[model samples]
Target: MNIIGGPAQDGEWPWQIALMWNNIYVCSAALLTPDWAVTTAQCVNQEASGYSILIGTNNLAEWSPNYQRQPVASVYKHPEYNTRIHDFDVALLRLTDPVEITDYSRTICIPTTDMSFEVGTTCYASGWGSSDGINEFLQEAQFSITSSNNCEGVTSNMLCADGIESSGACAGDEGGPLVSLVDTRWYLVGLTSKTTCGSGADVFTRMTAMYEWIAPILDGETPLSK
Candidate 1:
């Protein structure tokens, strides 16, 4: 995915992932753990058998020595997800096998309930999707979290970020991570719901708002886990 403005540094986005369905890039995902990831429900629309997760590399063509590929064991989309409104658009993924979490490959911390981000806090959205189309390298854009009222379509459960003309998600960034650096850790704040390509406001499903549905699953218990 192209950052619209430029490319991401090697290992800069260790938690970024390239998700494929039938060997073709479909969406972006964030590594919450070696065996688990988070994305948008809209992205998990197909069967798990055809899904593939690629990790540990910024450039798809140039495989980083520690790069790994794994199949999806299971997927759980939010029961309340509404496609028309794009509400509650979160999903949890179980990797067939856990990857080795290292400096070159790692997980992004999930935002806790108590952590609060202000309306003007700076955050980032990264993916392999470019403004023109899909690309081989990872790309990122910086945005200041805006208020829900700033956009007519945004709700309290979603976050809005006004994109600078050439700095936002596009064609392939859906289900990717929207993170903010908190102290020394990068906390995943949201999952991309859609891309505005940086011309306007970008949308995301707020992670903290979905914590109740995600907590039990992260604890390894969910009706869909069956």
Candidate 2:
């Protein structure tokens, strides 16, 4: 629970999803479209077929078995995703069944081709990672906006946030959304990719860089967001 302000208050921009595996592999993911979900490839790469997506709820305890357990129909890992160097760690999952879009469930807005955030823009990240800096079963977590320039030493696809060493996403938060407030709505700017572990920076896959790959899928021309 890497909460910055406090435990996630009940109704904050609720487009969150939980990727579950054997009732143990729990990680938060974001719905990018009715048919696609944006999450870290590492989260599902190991057991792609065994995973289930839980949408339309934030409180896991209240989630029911009937709550939309969509099977992952397909997974599109970024061609550049390399675990050794963590180059492009993002991936897209195509649901076996398209989720019904309602007031509580909707696709998040991706940054337009021209829109971007600078080195200093503030952004917020949320997930169900550990709360006490130790890995635990997934729990609600939050963190304040950190800057991007702090990750100059890593791959260009990775961005950084503020915090000395106490803030940022932890394990189990992988594949979650790194949101940026813009124009009165939060835009999907990055996908939680990795954390330095001991460092404060939580690296994310730059969504803008993969706009070309995700465009066809988002536009319905391609079957997957490759």
Candidate 3:
């Protein structure tokens, strides 16, 4: 996650999640529902016995009263996810316990409608990773939707964004959320799939393109899931 930006305040991005592997912060995630979180399949594939989720706090160095750490009950990587190219890069995480709703912990809306996050729409990408070193607190940067054509390897299932000049940072932003505000509510429009960190050409798994694969998983428990 390339988080070359300012530290985020508590509750600024409540849906944000800190993905843990062996108790160490690895990548970021988004709370999809009280019981479910969303991240990249790449992140899931790196899982080990210590997999867990850290919610309700912006800082990872300290465990506060609002902090809640839950073990991951299960992981569901998309069936069509491609490790070679990272296509269909999302994965759903089932938490052992539902995260209690609070100002510091909540879920964000995912794109599931016949809509497009048109070019030029402003969006924000947040994470706790560093471009140079690990950050103790969450950080964020703003980006503007750019034509996918600007970046090579852009695919039909991806959307591209260019970081604003004065901002943008990255250390290990894998599986972070790229969200946009629409009519007062923030929607998760993309997942950090790929990036050329320094120049800010981010390639994200466009959530809209995965509605078919995601809608079903979100509606009811699938009979068979990874």
Candidate 4:
């Protein structure tokens, strides 16, 4: 069994969102705007038509039972996203209606053009990924620091993060948030794109490289993040 960190404690950035489909649930997503969410393109790639965005809840158990279920109005996959190379695997989803950001549903701060994370620098990742190597249908959030490098042999856009011990994202944790604390505020540096499906380094799509593409969408100036 894969042993990992404990679930997210109360009141630590409660703006996370849970993406649900059928019996498969992925703790992958972060609220980017009142009407938009930042996650992995692959999360919506196969079944874009059937996914629902559950917002306004830190507690996954209460998500479906208590929170509002918003239909995905549109999905914007990066034009260059290639599953083969895993390049540009980032995507944004526009909700049919704007979700009111409460204490439990706030928009995450995106990094400014000047901010950049380096290798060996510590960052935090949270999601309803697996715990104890057991895959549950429910979602649970855990934390992990950034890895040493952003996939050294792989492409530059891929960011890496290792668990402090046996803690990290797993198979069902894709399309979540890989955040970095800069100047006391947490910036959405990466989107949890993929991992090895067990206790291993989790990969994310670097937000820095995709700023230009994502900016217009967040600002409502463009219909897509491409």
Candidate 5:
């Protein structure tokens, strides 16, 4: 039943993450707490000392005892986050320990309100990035929520969807995830940040306008400056 953009079915996204860096993988993160995670700050490039975070797995080549890697201890970013114009692209890693959630690892659902989800509202976008590279699994699509005036440097915290051409989420799909099921659960409203895979409109970075900089860094407390 994973249609719209396609390809994803074994365990269907358990908060999909894989941001490794020296072991490769390079981008796509979302497991909110087995030690926090939420990505895109230009994919936190280098220096969290070895970076890591594989977790559960939809096939990073296939291994699964529910995969699970771990190894990054700190890397917040969102002090305005304007890598050029991507504005608040979001970022938060912290996980040198805690990693073993159960039903195949989990955590996702951060939109305590700030609204915005009308235009068309279909949502659901996972990633393992593909343009002919990674992606042996983990890759859902089905976007819809459109009308940031149709993209073109979207703003207003940003959150546009609309996909088509070669599908969507490309180039290692930076900081993946863009969910939205609302009402039945599942809501991590956008994070793939920036795209033009073809049919236009992709931007994202409006997890309820950064929920006051992510609920005190998910309760470890202390976020509220800027």
Candidate 6:
């Protein structure tokens, strides 16, 4: 958690990944497939450099059997991403190779249809961001999807959530997931895009809106021959 929150329990968010640049945590990302992940463009618009992903671990300070770090092979940012306003803030990272899927590492299920979560829908936000730069454990919080009409700076394509003052994603939490539990399964609906910590509601890029650009790439990849 950033401004306010607690650490997530191990195995709580198996789909979570840490995106790092030159070994420093930059933002959080969601594993969509063994070889592909999604994050915010703001985290990757900079000049290409050494980028890697940490998977299958909740604790970042120490290593475990579940921990696996893989280098990024390529970056694909949404073409319409408006860097000025952080609109359409989404990006995809291709891994050098597919990661091993285990009990502690898994892919998140994304919505297939153009579904909209109504206001007050409960969703979970998870990341590893902190202001003091001391938090090493993954953090998460429960937030309800709200209307962006009153949230200043929020756009139509972004999903807004309330209670960010008391609980929500923090710095370094950028590009992490805002997921909704549907039918006993978690569905990624948004990405932590922008926020003011305790001052205002947090905003996340609606994942469904990016489906058109993401689906094609995901569909083209076949599972590695085991």
Count clashing residue pairs per candidate: 4, 6, 12, 3, 0, 0
lDDT of 3 by residue, 28-140 (tens): 89998888888988887634357899988988888657877888988878887888888888888888889999988989998875877999999999887666766788888
Root-mean-square deviation per candidate: 2.0, 3.4, 1.9, 3.3, 14.7, 3.9
What's the lDDT of the predicted structure labeled candidate 2? 0.68
- Candidate 2 structure quality by residue, lDDT tens digits, 1-226: 3534445534354566788776654677888888888787777764367777887665676663334657887778887678776677777788888988765566788776577777667677766675454332233334444565566556667666553336666676778787777878888877777764435667787788777777878667653333
Q: In candidate 3, where is summed lDDT lowest over 10 consecutive residues?
A: 217-226
Q: What lDDT score belongs to each candidate, Candidate 1 first?
A: 0.81, 0.68, 0.82, 0.67, 0.78, 0.81
TM-scores for candidates 1 onward, in order: 0.93, 0.83, 0.93, 0.82, 0.34, 0.92
Candidate 1 per-residue lDDT over residues 57-141, each given as its tens digit: 8787777777888899888888888888788888888899997888878999988677788898888888887767678778777
Model 1 pairs whose backbones collide:
1-128, 1-129, 2-129, 2-130
The residue-level lDDT of candidate 4 at 150 comes to 35
* Regions more than 4 Å wrong, model 6: 1-5, 46-48, 221-226
Candidate 3 vs candidate 4, lDDT winner: 3
**Candidate 5 global TM-score:** 0.34
Q: Report lDDT (Cα) of residue 210, candidate 3.
A: 75
Cα lDDT, model 4, residue 151:
42
Query: Which candidate do you rate higher for TM-score, 2 or 6?
Result: 6
- TM-score of candidate 4 against the unseen true structure: 0.82
**CA displacement after TM-score superposition, residue 218 of candidate 6 (Å):** 2.4
Give the Å shift of residue 67 in candidate 4: 3.0
lDDT of 6 by residue, 100-171 (tens): 999888999877756778899988888877766636788877788887874777776688886544775667
Q: Model 4, range 1-226, lDDT digits (tens) per residue? A: 2214445544465556777665356546788888888788887863357667876554665543335567677788888888786788788887888877665567888876666787666666666665443343333334444554534334667777765655666665678777777777778878776665445676778888878788897656654444
Best by lDDT: 3
The digit string of per-residue lDDT tens for model 5 on 49-159 reads 888888787778875876778889777787888889878888888888987877777888788656667778888788877766777778787788878888888788887
